[model samples]
Target: MSQPTSRPTTATRVYLARLKGTAVFDPLGDQVGRVHDVVVVMRLKGAPRAVGLVVEVTGKRRVFVPLTRVTSIDAGAVITTGRLNIRRFEQRPTETLVVGELLDRQVTFRDDSGTATVKDVAMEQQRNRDWHVTKLFVRRAARGGLMGRRGEGLVVDIEDVTGLAVNPAHQGATALLATLEDLKPADLADVLHDLPDTRRLEVAAGLPDDRLADVLEELGEDDRVSIVSGLDVERAADVLEAMEPDDAADLVSELPDAKAAELLERMEPEDAKDVRRLLAYEHLTAGGLMTTEPVILPPEATIATALAHARRQDVTPALAAMLFIVRPPLETPTGRLLGVIHLQRALREPPHELIGAILDKDVEHLLPDDDIGKVTRLLATYNLTALPVVDEDRRLLGAVSVDDVLDNLLPDDWRGADEEITDQAMTRTAHG
Candidate 1:
């Protein structure tokens, strides 16, 4: 409730700070109400800032004070000289706007080509020690069909939106994107389906690829294809390259053949081949989730050498949790399938020991033709970071990382300015 020392830039600037219980006073110096909320009218270019103050005027009689006439503020109340009687102000809107009333409601705005919905607001504490709303988090619009039934979609950020208003009377209940903190992925997916296409895409582009992939997977094949189609090929390739090969393959395979080929053409050769191979199988099969980047190593390699190989590879740190040991000879080999070794355990052993000697001989793996459900269960049951998919002959084909599995399960809100979890970390100023 502390005020900033600087003069505010505009009327809307006054609404940037939270004002849940500020006092309201009239001309005779009599306190008329307690402010319960500050409604912000977000404006873009060429628009005026309008703010509505929700105030509790008397016992059970609530009024909205237009912020245009507010003159001053001190420790006790806000000074205003608006002409409306308390009852008349209350009757003007017919729709009550309170902080609590607006809590989970989806506020929409017109953007580049469609509408965006308020996903979250980004605020931070300044060096001078006042809090202010800096950005309005919006879910980018979704495309394809009405009621989330079909088509490709993409999510990205739409910057500098400045207006916020209530939906017209005929729009029914406002549907909002959930930021309730702990909602399950399933529930979050339902919320994603309710958002307009533009809002969904904006939110999607902001999140990390892993989380976005999880949400897309949860949306089912058609929705996933639609969402990916909205992204440029480069963006799509970046996402595909980041995802586990199998999952990436599954998404691309679901796209129209032309689009899928175009996306593949944009990816790195090794990645393109892996995805193309995965596309040859039914989506529900294990091949759909198999990656081609298993941690292959030679039988002659010592623990020291294997460790060095993992560091040199582009595989994520998570994938290094378990390192795959293959024959030393790349073309043809004569060693048995040495058990997989936990990268941590391998690191602790004496440097001179060959990797095969330290491996846990009992290896559990799946054939490429196996069901995806089996692969998921193995990942969950053993709490693995990367699972190796093999051929019927026990030769390694590729690997699936835990991150890939998650992408298949959530609505991609990839981190955006609005989804920013970290506000500036503020330290209290010492008294001078």
Candidate 2:
């Protein structure tokens, strides 16, 4: 097989259904594999474009063959450059398997017609030798069922399809969220950042407060700001309140002065107050990095009570790692700091035992003015995930989490590096 002498016109669209399962021939017309799936790379700002084809070779092993290797698309056959690598196919962060992710998926038309199932994707090879998904062939269910056994099929441009068309075999948003639930906040945030804007917002809107806050905290400043700025004041305030005070303050500080003030005013008085206090501190100081919402329990409270509070759905695992035992006034910026109880101690203690009895009194603490260097030194020296901040009067102020410290310590483009690492790890896990 050789390159086709003539190319198809713009009016001629090759449907994915007809191309899939067809024979693939090498340069000398030797059959090597069969086309199993099409691979495309999605862009944040544009329509996805085909990059390669997943071909099932002998021994039923599938491999990815770049579009550059394909010389021509003929009737029921794909002509290639004659060379094929014998390795299994694995998707990258930028790639999506069209058959696994989009074919037979439900898609909404821009004109608001009822949802239709994707029958095939129409691809047109551009002059640049690139294959782009230009249209979609979708089948809509008929109104009546008994007599109308067939559905209406229409070919529409890819632009007309709303949001990402997920695989029909997979559950929708709920399933997506469930699968992503176990991912670290940073990893999940990376996934969200890669998604199309509309889908990103949709996923963000569906997440509960704690989960959303965690994910937002893990995102870069620009990504976090973009996502939050898109929300209405009420929703934005709600998400901020759900986040650790320091992270929330950092995000709000990036907003325009007027917009930040408006959001703060709309937030709950307590939550707003905590964020405002953090905002007042220098960005590199302990006060700026500390969260005002660490798990605080009264000195008289029992282990059971502390454990129960820690177990609350609203409390994040990071925050629940330790409990700060304070005197009379239980809230932060209150009575003298007493001691701290690690979760391990709380769990091993008797249910009714007072937290005061198990307090680890020699706790290393920090003052609001302490710099990031000092904070990091103290945390690393003590091997601590959180360290309490105290006032001149030794009143408990807030606690800085290790995550915040690391955020400041790492290079500015840490998020990009993290995303790459996470993607590679996930790809390995998927293939294995």
Candidate 3:
């Protein structure tokens, strides 16, 4: 959260807008996950009662943690018992995703003081140890305003707002998105998945190209397709261009042939060319799975140059794990493949040393037709995070990361590994 608040005092009223993305810690002072969103039970005549939290654990899997298990909610963290359910979270029929559903609601002050968009909702603990959304921080304008003015803002009891139940025909995402601006792409994708189509598209449109591309890669295929389809062709093309060549190709492959062709036509030629090349191969094969943008350096490059390339933020950790050594034309499908250099070896060598002198020439190559089984075996056997794929001429084409292999290998619902909760501490686990 905010660095342990510099001290540990419980908050009387917690604003969920601030709680999104906060750290969820076990009592032993170990972090287990993050607060993705608050789950609430919406009432007909009154405010929604806080049910629990949707905490995203490792592996991007989310589980429900009952508020009853929440020992404290301070400015910094939500401390809980170490015991937790390992099962996946499924929204109950009567539950509402407060962060998604309640925020940004266009509401009228009960006294008719004027309307405002809900910026954040505050929950207070009751005598019975229950929690309810008793207050709201709202703005007199849409976000600041439709014309971008610095609108009046205020915090008042929830009973003072009349439109809490109104589902506006159109809603602004700026405020809600701002609250979640720090979320990782995967976590953001989860939030988007739970939102209605219109809000999801609104939020998606607000994200920068690169950020949206990353989320697209993490979304379920159906959601990905739905979001992409909802966008006009040009926007879809831009998003695809921002993705890795292999990922872009996979997304395009999911579309109808004509639509895919149109998107490819609109993309920048160089990016389109790489994706088209990848599309030429069958799924699960080396060419299909490998990203065309792997680090490709010539033998003549210095160890220093290789290290510099590895340090670039654009290069993924898996891609940087191994450097593909080639003869000339460092781009994929370049000159004949020469050897490979492990990043560790590069670190040990003098910066001035030639990469060629220390290259691992014995490294095996994966052909375009090599299946995923072979890719997995090779990566696992050598303890390698990435492996090179090459053309028949032994020219470097691309490299496949272990993550890519896992994506193809896992079941469609792998993100939510749905095992029932086994922890005895969660015997009273909230509805899945």
Top candidate when judged by TM-score against the true structure? 3
Write one digit per residue (lDDT tens) for candidate 2, span 1-432: 121222233434466666778899985689998999888755443556676799999999997776765766754688885646564666643356777887878887777655778877767876644577887777775555653335777777788877554343323554566556557778899999898887787677656445688899888877788888887777677778768788899999988899999999988787888889889999888999898878888888888888876764445566688889888576788789898999987899899998989999999999999888788778878878889999999899999888777677665675666353334433322332
Output the number of the lDDT-best candidate.
3
List model 1 lDDT by residue over 1-432, tens digit each.
122323343433332234456778764477778776654332222222223567777785765554433555443467765333343232222233435443334433444344455533333333422233454434545755574432222222224442344443422221222141134445555566667877666555543343455566556665567678887676677567656576687777678889988888887676677778878866545566556665667666788877765653244676778777765433111133456878888879998998878776665676767665666678778878777766656666666676655444323353222553232211111110
Query: What are the lDDT scores of the predictions, listed in order?
Result: 0.55, 0.75, 0.78
C-alpha lDDT (0 to 100) for residue 167 of candidate 3: 40
Backbone clashes in candidate 3 total: 0
Give all TM-scores, in the order shown.
0.42, 0.55, 0.58
Worst 10 residues of 1 by lDDT: 423-432
After superposing candidate 3 on the true structure, give the runs of residues whose Cα lies further than 4 Å from its correct spot.
1-171, 420-432
* Candidates sorted on lDDT, descending: 3, 2, 1
**TM-score of decoy 2:** 0.55
The segments of candidate 2 whose C-alpha lies over 4 angstroms from its true place after superposition are 1-184, 418-432
lDDT of 3 by residue, 50-124 (tens): 868899999999977877658778657998845465556667444578788888888887775567888887888
Runs of candidate 1 exceeding 4 Å displacement = 1-194, 205-223, 300-320, 328-337, 351-353, 372-387, 400-432
Candidate 1 lDDT (Cα, whole model)? 0.55
Between candidates 1 and 2, the lDDT winner:
2
